[model samples]
Target: MEHPILFISLILEKLGLPIPHGLIGETFLEKMCQPYMTYTWFVMIFLVVVGKLTLSNIEMIPGKGQNFWEMLIGGMYDFFEENMGRELAEKLFPMIATFGLYIAVANLIGLIPGFMSPTASINTTVALTIIVWVTHHIIGIRAHGLGYIKHFLGPIPVLIPLMLFIEIISNIARLASLSIRLFGNIMAKETLLTILFILAGAYFAPLPIMVLGVLVSLVQAMVFVLLTVVYFGQANEHAH
Candidate 1:
């Protein structure tokens, strides 16, 4: 099959709904694949919808669903508060939390037999990287004003141009680094599982790898969030 997770389309088709036209037609890997409607794209949207419903359906008084949602949000609030400080973290909490949960769910779900991690796709990852990158810069500018540009310059006047040039490249490089890191890790994990399934055809042997994948998934998501936090912190910092 052209698509890595062909069964996703198959199952959706058998549900009596029309098969997604794009899936029925061409492979995502094919030339001129539209970015808007890939399997991973749908999966990402499905997750966001579920999360929105979960939050929307929550009650004021505690119950199973409310408690679960509260704990998740509460814990994340504390986590970011500790990392980025109460003020900055609270300010950026929504963006950080959303990014973290989406990525974490996307990675973990890919462990299932028929799901593919959207982060495994360069397009998905690059888009995320761009979002994070733009967010920090916008926050930085709003927080610190034009003085933010001074951070790119070195302490010494003579080195200002060189430092500014290097800093520009370094900041831009973050987009590539963020995209490649997430994509490489997820793609490697999926590729390894595929190879093991083909070679041994045993259910048990891949269990260890799957367990490791879970840890790696969480770590990758955490790393992505933490780096964003770091950027946010740096962005708001006053130039010395």
Candidate 2:
């Protein structure tokens, strides 16, 4: 099947820039500028620019921009607090917010004519899963010290072997679940939208699906954040 053309790469080529494929031909720049990676960098830069603009001027009365950001940050903080408790929310608000914004933007960008969602790439999702996996384990170790091992070992001494094996498998499964879930959903969404637009042969025909895509994008991002919060909460808990 023919894939949708990544307009970002096309633009770079037109601008006489070094791109991954046609212009650069098998070079290091080509390796670095994979479609997903290029869009990922765009998302990061977009977030950084928006954040800088939002924080550049603090107003007591709060303008429209300020109010929107305040509502977004405050609402997200409340949601995290509700799910993970105030203390954990306070500790993790920044990381969770960053993940939510990045994922949400990355997902939505693909719906635009020129861009593709980075999360559609398994490599990108795997990287995100790895970060969450390592972070929660670190949180567990820091919270419980060496006793974190007891989390994997059941209370009964006789069950340690079975419990440890089960826990190891479960944790590995978590990694796969997180990565594959995001990657599959996004890949499917992008592929379906692309095919729908092509089959319909008109831009307006896919309007309803595009609207649904926006909702799916936001819901997926929220689901990812919620699961992360749950994992952190579990890691923060005392051994049962």
Give the poorly placed runs of model 2, Cα more than 4 Å off: 21-26
Q: Compared with the true structure, what per-residue lDDT tens digits does model 2 show for residues 49-160?
A: 9878877899899887789999999999988888778887898888889999999999999888768999998889999999999999999999899999988997898999
lDDT of 2: 0.87
lDDT of 1 by residue, 55-154 (tens): 6765668777668878988988888887767888878898888898888988887788766777777777888889999988998899878888887896
TM-score of 1: 0.81
Q: Which one wins on lDDT?
A: 2
Top candidate, metric TM-score: 2
Q: What is the clash tally of candidate 1?
A: 0
Candidate 1 Cα errors over 4 Å, as ranges? 1-5, 11-38, 41-61, 85-87
